[model samples]
Target: MTTVTAPPPPAARTATPAPLVSVRGLQVAYGDGPLVLDGVDLDLFPGETVALLGSSGSGKSTLMKSLTGFAPITGGSAQVAGHDVGTLRRGRLRNLRADVGQVFQQFNLVGRLSVLTNVLTGALHGAGPVNAVGGFSSADRQRAMALLDRVGIAHKAKDQARTLSGGQQQRVAIARALMQRPRLILADEPVASLDPTMSHQVLDLLQEIARADGIPVLVSLHVLHLALDHSDRVVGLRHGEVLVSSPTAELDAERLAVVYDVSDADQEADDAGH
Candidate 1:
């Protein structure tokens, strides 16, 4: 007979390990369009949740995409899980993506599939299309079932994805991401479609996962208060640049207000015309 025990505390910040995801002087553009990310820099360390805060068009989504080579990286470098995203060829890029797990606002599930089956699909990331249908091994299925239990939705494993409520479905999405055994997790506005009550629950769960799994979670969020509540560090972007980056313990809504202040953008334009 055995009893579960909590793990020991992490080493001091000075002794913290190197970041799993590192971005430096990053830039992204889409075919003659203006730069969407300009000299952006970010880092995600293990056992931490970094809330990415910004209003619309702040380049939050682009930064996330650049990590896995989904965004066209025009300048600088992004090292994710030890892979240089900007320099990776197609074959290696696929490996880079397999190392990162992603969550979305829409909860992107195959509505007709069972929750368990959907989670199992995460194991298909590196496997070729040959295993897309009915090819999961017993170990993969066991892991998927365990992930569902970890996310607290094991009871709903047999339910159709379309039948679950918004919050429950999001939990399943998270379980699916965990199925990938991801080194870093990126959640793009995962709570945007959820109600306030559900929002807190989902965010709380993400933070818990970060701490327990020792995996860094970089979550983009539009709501300032939610970021304040759910993250260990806060990185706020404005007009494709990082306006503020600090530990959440040192920040408040007042300090974060500039990220959303439209007048700042107007002021920049005014100065540019000079």
Candidate 2:
């Protein structure tokens, strides 16, 4: 009789909660140009605020665009909310884009529109276009007001978006992103134009939203102290690659210096994308 041996039981593995956004060995380039991002790996989990830190040209913006299907992924795999972004069809790509909420540095709200109407535009993400902004349903109007209130700007709902302060306008932009009822949020330098006080407030609100709603928030930042103070985690990029990824408590300005090729971490810009 041949000797037979039973295989040993498999090793017990630690349980890790699935990430809302997951990327592995990601690479991005444009039309034969050199890679903008190279071999990046990242994850954004629920109920966390992750800041992206890097100098300009460090692939911050490009990383973000990849998640929405705007940046071309030349290699690796990106799975977002269960969708394989690299191989998605156009229709699926549209659906993928609809699920992610975006906030910009310039506060991309319609200057001529009422703040309430601007917030309602977010509801159009998954829903098809309507006859007009004025034609939004009363239910949506109520939800818009609720989002504005959540962002602490419900009183400005009737005012034109351009009439608000820079900080308040940024708040409106944030409320608009919230109105989407998004599964994930990408804030690309959302507080760059605001005063220091407003920046803190906005960051605080984002953190609260992540906790209350159990969603991940990925914010790109240019200021170092803000990233340290505002985010629960930090992801530092250097020349299109992730140099450091750690809990905020474990990193300091000196620890992040290499990301900027500097003597200290007072410079730059996250969970990441693009």
Candidate 3:
């Protein structure tokens, strides 16, 4: 008779709560237009940087906008910072926005305002009678300064925002976002205007913030190399649909080719048809 061996037991699974941001079957359309985002799903966990990648018009920015209630979400569900984005009330919308930090490509700072002042504005969201001109609490100022320092722009606190270089401006914008004490961050093309060096610096800083603060960062990027180099995971979009979503370690440049393929094939078909 042949001998038989029993198999070992399977490992136990750990129980973790929901992610900082959860999205499912997300669909969006503007003014009766075609769906800009269709059947999308995403998750952003604590201490992770998730890069959003796509060609132009692929719905990359639209996805980011949906998280903050900027885009018109027609269907599906989205939750960010513990708020149900699709169902937020008029009053609750402000609260939701306050909890979400945002960074943008243009560094959306008041060019005439002092860097510190610009950073302080982040606290105004949902703030009730905080005296924007001359009445910020001492603790708020200290925190803003600390955030500026964290972004490596503390020494320029007194300088006008317009005087700063592109990298410095972006850094200041990041510091401003930090001032919000946000649970989740949505960075839409945060490094699009920066040079190669500045882009790397900004992305590295964002990644470090994500890990250190235990916050989830969802940053949109056009450059494939930057996404691969900086993110813990990547979500690729093609013509408003998700083409690839996976951990960075499990992916490479070739694997992300799907983001460009849909548009490329359409162009090819047009040529062939002609």
Candidate 4:
């Protein structure tokens, strides 16, 4: 008789790095309007993908904007890459933005430029004014090509950005963001315009980048299933407040339903009319 024993279980995962982006009691509002984001707190750790979820007007976009200084913070603190977002001077703010890469729903790209050229533009985030005659350097061009290849679109590097399909255009946008070597990535509704398949592909790519580069990716998403399927953590907002924050493995559609619940007035009105 021979005795067999299974190998001991692997060691528990190491503690995560200090948060690259931190927010506490964050509040935001437009002039004279009600608070768009209220009493929100969030922390983004390196090599993690966090999904922001909410229905329309739920403050998801406002929260993302606050992280980059686009939204006015009425109270609380938001620190990104060691800079206090609300109190940073203009130059420091520019430096902060340079360290943070952004992807938008619209795939903000210059349609007329070649995909490679568009990616190179990412290097301009914190760069001084360029000499029109000198243009991009050989090193910058090579780096841009490499990023395009990483995104699986090196073949489209020579094509006009406008000529590619929606998925392809998004790949170009992602490559462009990577060209910045960002410490944090903010993706605001990044896949809202894509079909279901493209949505999965794009989200998968974002998570891969987060893990491989040790960058924190905070992406706002409308689809519940997508968040559950792609993100490591989920933060749900409702009526300008955080309603839920937990690991994706511990959450499901039932647990998230409260984030999008209808108001009492609406429900009563429906019953009265019936």
Candidate 5:
């Protein structure tokens, strides 16, 4: 026997990298209302796409907002890109937002602007007043075009953003996110407005971006199959708590259904009311 032991398994691969986003015991509420997120813990490492799965009102969007300092952190802590989101000052919060790229269900583009200009607007994040007045620089224009090309829409760059189809507009939105050079990407039901085919395409592009750029992508999705197909890991939320967290490889529709399971008390209430 050689007894080589496979070179000590390559030193255990140097341990996994530190998470770009870490949330511990996170809790959120809205102006004395009920808790939206309770004791939620999450971690997002570089180059990974983590799907956030939940039904309506499951705190999925609130969790994303917590990471960006948009939600009220009633308790616990959330750290994104090394900034403590719950305690960040105004300027630092702006920096944190700048470092994050956000995609929404409705493509939030200036309809009147050209596709190229819409993409370039992403660079305005954390910019000074002068940059806004002077307009985007030539370098910015070049980079915006390059990003549009990368998203497979260079030819449409000159057209008004609203002129593109849903899928094409979503692509432009993604390119705009890329224009931010984000350290992390947060997509809140990004594919909710698209057809199944376009949903697949946009999710595929987001995963590719996460891997290629080594950035963490946290995407909230209502569709089970899409999450199963696209993510490296899955975090399932239910009634403001994490009900399931596991590698996507080990998850299926049956396993993930727990996230959406109705509680006995609620079911009893429904039955009684009926």
Candidate 6:
């Protein structure tokens, strides 16, 4: 009898990648316009919520779009969930979209649809055309309800999406995203429409999901306080450049103001000269 060993347990799969989303020297420009994003580098690792902060037009939205292949990448590379944004073909784009869960500022729910139906739409990305017209399967409905429960809104499942309050609606949006079973999540100013209290609530929820699911959550926020309160790391952009990238505990409002205040100062100087 040959001495058989179990191949040393396959080496414990030790060389796992550091991040689920890796972006290097990412550049994005619209048609013939100047670069909206220039050499931006960001990495979103599992179990972390990275808050992207900047004043308006610092390319925060553009950076998020680049990861999903919505913006034109004039140069550099973006790899999200192991797919190369710059190089993926059409079929791959569908797969990429299916893997990434996106939450928009508007919540993006269909108002007239039942909250559960809206959440069920997320599963469409992973479904075929034949399955769509037939409506959601029992398994999909169950999963959507589970997602709603996870987001603390299972009771609202039968309500029309528009009937919910802003915070509740946002919770529905989050549930919709979770229904995709995404490998990564990108939220663009997810709480900009909510009040201070609701904003805190939503951000806390996002952070909780990131840690619990061990998925990277990249959220853009206009408020410095919110970012500091909820994120594990903060990345600040200024004039389309990365001005600050550091762990949240190591940064504060004063330093972060560099990204927000300078634009105001420049406008003031121009007005004074005029």
Q: Which lDDT tens digits does candidate 1 get at residues 1-274?
A: 8998889888767777899988999999999999999999998999999999888889999999989998999999999999989999999998998999899999999999999999998998856565666688888889999999988999999999999999999999999999989999999999999998999999999999999999999999977778988999999998789989999999977778788757554443342233
Q: What is the lDDT of candidate 4?
A: 0.89
lDDT per residue, candidate 5, 1-274, as tens digits? 6775555444545688999998999989899789989999999999999999988889999999988988889999998998999888898999999999999999899999899999988988945785677488888899999999998999998899999999999899999998889999999999998987899999999999999999999999877888888999999999999999999999877777778856533432332233
TM-scores of the candidates in the order shown: 0.89, 0.89, 0.89, 0.89, 0.91, 0.89
**Which is the winner by TM-score between candidate 1 and candidate 5?**
5
The lDDT of each candidate is 0.90, 0.87, 0.88, 0.89, 0.89, 0.89
Where in model 2 is the C-alpha error above 4 Å? Answer: 1-15, 128-134, 263-274
Candidate 2 lDDT (Cα, 0 to 1): 0.87
Poorest 10 consecutive residues by lDDT, candidate 5: 265-274
Model 4: worst 10 consecutive residues (lDDT sum): 265-274
**TM-score, structure 3 vs. true:** 0.89
Point out where model 5 deviates above 4 Å: 1-12, 262-274
Clashes of 1: 0
Q: Is candidate 2 or candidate 5 better by lDDT?
A: 5
Residue 28 CA displacement from its true place in model 2, Å = 0.3
Of the two candidates 3 and 5, the one with more favorable TM-score, higher being better, is: 5
RMSD of 4: 5.9
For model 2, state the Cα shift of residue 269 in Å. Answer: 13
For lDDT, the strongest prediction is 1
- The candidate scoring highest on TM-score is 5
**Two-way lDDT contest, 1 vs 4, winner:** 1
For candidate 3, write residues 37-154 as lDDT tens digits. Answer: 9999998999999999887899999998888888988999998888899888778888998898999999899999999999998878745674545567788899999999999999
